[model samples]
Target chain A: MSTLVLPDQQVRVENTTVRHVRPTRRLGASLRKTLYRSGAIIGFLLVWELVPQFVLEPASRVFLPPLHEVLQQLWKMIISGDLGTHIVASLGRSAIGFILAVIIGVPVGLVVAWFAKVGDFLNPLLEVFRNTAALALLPVFTLLLGIGELSKVSIVLYAAFFPVLLNTILGARSVDPLLIRAGKTLGLNNFEIFSKVVLPASVPIIFTGIRMAGTSAVLVLIAAEMIGAKAGLGYLITNSQASFLIPKMYAAILTVAVLGFVVNAALVALEQHFSRWARA
Target chain B: MSTIEIKNLTKKFLRSGANESTAVTAIESLDLRIEDGEFFTLVGPSGCGKSTLLDILAGLSTPSHGEVLVDGEPISGPSLERSVVFQQYALFPWLTAAANVLVGLESQARHGQGPNKADRRARAHEYLRLVGLEGVEDKYPHELSGGMRQRVAIARALAHEPKVLLMDEPFAALDAQTREQLQDLLLDIWKRTRTTIVFITHGIEEAVYLGQKVAVMSAKPGKITEIVDIELQDRQAVDDIRSTRQFGEYRHYLWTLLHRHGRQGEEATIDKTLITSGASA
Candidate 1:
């Protein structure tokens, strides 16, 4: 070992390499975590199964059916391809609206943020529009485009756009000045600097925006479908409820919840893929 | 021949929403010349405009008065011929070490009669090796240590084969041992490359050890107060030279010059220049 003295501390540079201890070696900690996660789900299912089976009277069980009955109903829906139809319908509308929001929002955000004159011109109007709710604009969209796919998609678009645009603006503007200067010193022009330095720096935030937009788009699509749609999960829930089919309504609600979770997971995966450099 | 010449250069920063009369002067009427292929250092306390001066020389910032000429021509803006190693590392966190160096080569390669893609990769690898970073071609800036990041920045600056390398306290953030190690490595690189270097630092010992000539600056509307010539017969044996009494004398002289100027400027009571001069005092 060679010893070196610094202004604040003495450092010993050891020739012998140190091995990292495996986290798995601490079995108790990891085992408890696994057990806790599994226990929560299993425990929840047990309560769902038992509450209606033992605690609830026959009359109450009419509204809150046992877990197995609900599962049976869901299974029947799947076999008949009804669940698949509703899922595909909901996903298609959400996809179209969210994708449109991304295409328009990202570039508009970057352009406004990068160009000061443009940002100054648009910021006040953006804030005003963002504050006004997408749900509130439902009547306006229906009046303009009619109660069809366009109106439903437009509402989702409105809901998804602001989050992506606002977050993107924040991302592009928050790029460190030091990095910009470094690019300049390396003889990169403004366009090159923006593409190389600013864009990469903004990736993490932009992904956050995308994730937010995805969630918002799914939410707004469901709400729009609830207001006026025939084949989607939202319509399935409302129709089943009106007809007193509690199990089918619960299945539709569960499907929508699962779909939202899946969308979030997919977005998280995309964020991880694009910003792997940051994890380093 | 002087590679860089500053003739009465000045820089003023306008306060936000403030009129012209409220502008703060970062540099004023500074005249300096850096010789070709020479290791020159600018040492001053905080707010002494040493960074401003370097920025002006790098052509990253325009001088409000007079001009900075590189190779007898005025510097209009940043060019591939003059590159800088920023104090913050600024290694483009998204890029790996090799790719960071490649950024310089890519820009230079855009012009005709430049290195091909294969040669540019080879040169990037060569520079990384020169900075003693091997088998880490794919390591991103965030994955590396502070010293390693600075070394990558140094390698990136050198990869372009710039006529002048401008470094703004590149070692200021490193530990003593790492700083010393980098100092020795830099001297070795300087000997081999023989590129004109203008290094900025706050440490008197660093200035004495690395530079053939050191310029000291005063704070509050900063300007160069003194320039000291360092005569070292053996630049190769830097460790031995640093241990000699002559090195102590040079360090002491520069320290005294900085101390005097720092004290004189401290009493001015100018609230605008809150940053202490380069001197630790």
Candidate 2:
């Protein structure tokens, strides 16, 4: 125990020796890293702000408003409480559709991948349906389900489902056969092998599919809303454009971008949480 | 009571898919007896079905003919009593070393190997310590070195207290120095546990050093040619017995036995690159 304690302490000291000697250098290095990481985004934003203000003609100003004007309109909508209502409507529809897709698609994928008979029967159908565009079915879904939340939500679910299902099947199927052999040697049954070995091993690939589905969910939801909806960011953008409130339309579009960014960030965080062991 | 009796055991792999005529014999009428609690080593030319034989003993693959019995009970599938340590350290990448050991313990719980869950965990730690991997139990396989990962694999194989341990070129991937170190470590553990071990390797040095009975095999229809009983002194003392003249004599004898094809003019060489490589399904 005494020997163990000394080695651990020595390791800790070795790890932090540079920091202890020159803490300012470490801080400066991190600051430089941050600057380098964000340099491109900062440049892009500056270009957006300056290009419309200086380069574009006055006639083009109505179509491509200045960034500050769009920001000001965004603030106006926030203070007036109109932005909150639209955001809630859009988020609710997207969230419900995405979550539903995940809840249904993942298990179906697991089942099909694990059992060969099921996979053989469903493979051709899936190939056809997944290839036939989700947006192509928009009019059909609207006509069948009516233009209520059902149609919009169903469209989002349809768009997201294939990615989650296909990726999960691929994930489950791609598990190292060596790992399964090891499990069998340890006396694991088929179910035990599936749960203990196959499921955990398939996580990284499955997460990749879910990330794709997450992007799909948001994009499909916005498209559905643009086609037919009383409220939501897509509806707001379309309505503002129709009313010739160009700045507000730009602001609503920015809000939609922010929402997509947040969903992606959340999905990435979840992926890291599950697969931290994979980090070298 | 873990005596393994292989009675006319044979395995064949079809060269082309769905072709019955071109079936190549991997193991042909292989008959051998491994006494209880003995360290057995098998050596052969590359592609001589040494790994295939190990897989069959572990109940991982079915023999085309005949049967393998452990204490007169024929095995049809994998059992908790027989644990296998593959050359590829097949630890679950997502699991820590401790969790991997725990998997083995849990598998053997039905056989009443470990008393309970808590005792099983303690045994897992004990086995890891036995393999000289005391502090890295919580580390994932990728975080450890190749030798360390193989140690975890050994710990997992032994943690369940199996009656027989099957190893297939377990140290073939390590560097020369690490390989020697693990060889010594394995000897020490085998001495203590007295578990029935069937080790397969292409290295003649490994076969001579660790095995009580080293069986030499021939390829093109894999079958045992000769069984050499090694008699050496002070194996438990840990002084390098490999340098001794008696060890050299056994090693040279096995080398000549493997190289007999040169005199016969059947094949030029035994595929030197495949000295440590094997094929499997």
Candidate 3:
């Protein structure tokens, strides 16, 4: 994992990418950042593999499985298509809940922010709900909606919704009034100004909320699955742990972490595209 | 002809929160007329209501007491016929340079007063070129320098072929070299377009250099103290108008007026730069 080859031609490249052309230096810096992160992760994995062998007793070693055993189990599950099934199940639930949250949250947030009356009414109500954690309402959701996909998805939705909604309101509110005044002088009517100026200006900030919600959706879905679901990454983790399949449990946990990281990376890319395109 | 007429104009804002009792009078019973195709500039200290007056003329703000008329008709709300260039270069950040200019063109297209879609795009390109910004159609506002951004803003303001253009200290944020360059560029553009302009600035040199008639304004119940008609009719023909004796005299006179009746509510600090620029050297 730490097989990083030193780039021999960097000196010439850095000199050529001097003062004006900045993207090359930025790209190099980003690569360096990624390398440092990968190095830390590799260092952690090495510690995980080695620490249990020398430090833990044989009885406790079963609980703290080595990295190679986890990887082996992960590979075996992949070859047998078991990992794929759990991944598909987990991803589908997470995506559905996240998409639904976004669909409901964004427009509602925009409308609420745009209309003073709607904002005045919803602000206090939203403030109350946002403070109350989604997991706190899990039993209520299960009792009302039953221990099915609906309840699980509802938990994810509830977890994800507030971040998206609140951020959107903040983004819309944070639009520069100077821009609005400029829009008026440019002869843009109310709807035109809202669509052209307010909407576009708020997008980068709105994406921040969506990114937070993305993380929440996945995390909350996993927790919800552990509570009720029969087949998901979270369920697999609990099941393998109950059966003393520590390696398989570790593998599932690793998969969930990777999935969460991937989702976050994709959202970060989307946000960067919007913001960078604004300057392009 | 966009003959702007100001009749007993006034504007007041009720102070928010702690000082909500007394209304802040930004402009009080101000009256001024800008003729068709005239290059008019308003000069005052920072607290004076020159920007407020410009905003009222642009219809971004309503007059509290009297009215402003363009071509003998009372101004309503902000319309395409009157465009404004703001000091901060209020170009839309999300849009490319040409796209920002296209925003103003959209108003013309709405009224069927503009050309076809293709010509409109061409016209946006043309307006950008008119402001000396070429090969930057796809560049967004954040990508450009402050001066370039302001040029894009000027292009946007002029894109609709507005009968009157109201500029509120448009070059205040720019560097000295860029400001001078833009001033000459603006003069050249005004020569060709002949659009009625109401420019607001605190600099006496900028006021004299730009306006055919420079209106000196006093702060605290803001009103025009004097309107000095500039006689440098062949300003374009001169080698360096700012260096001319007549130009210096106009700048010095405006500076003296400002020094005497600049701000009624605050102490007027002597500007060091104006002392040299207003010199008849």
lDDT of 1 at A5: 22
* Candidate 1 docking classification: acceptable
Give the residue spans of candidate 3 off by over 4 A. Answer: A1-34, A277-280, B17-20, B262-281
- Indicate the residue-level lDDT of A209 in model 1: 93
Q: lDDT of candidate 1? A: 0.85
Model 3 docking tier (incorrect/acceptable/medium/high): acceptable
lDDT of 2 by residue, A30-119 (tens): 999999999999897788788888998889967988788899999999999999999999889888888899999999999999998999
Poorest 10 consecutive residues by lDDT, candidate 2 chain A: A1-10
Going through the candidates in the order shown, the clash numbers are 7, 0, 0
User: Per-prediction interface RMSD?
Assistant: 7.1, 5.8, 15.9
Query: What ranking emerges by DockQ with the best candidate at the front?
Result: 2, 1, 3
> Better model by DockQ, 2 or 3?
2
- For the candidates in turn, chain A alone yields TM-scores of 0.88, 0.89, 0.88
| Top candidate (DockQ) | 2
Worst 10 residues of 3 chain A by lDDT: A1-10
Q: For residue A185, what is the lDDT in candidate 3?
A: 85
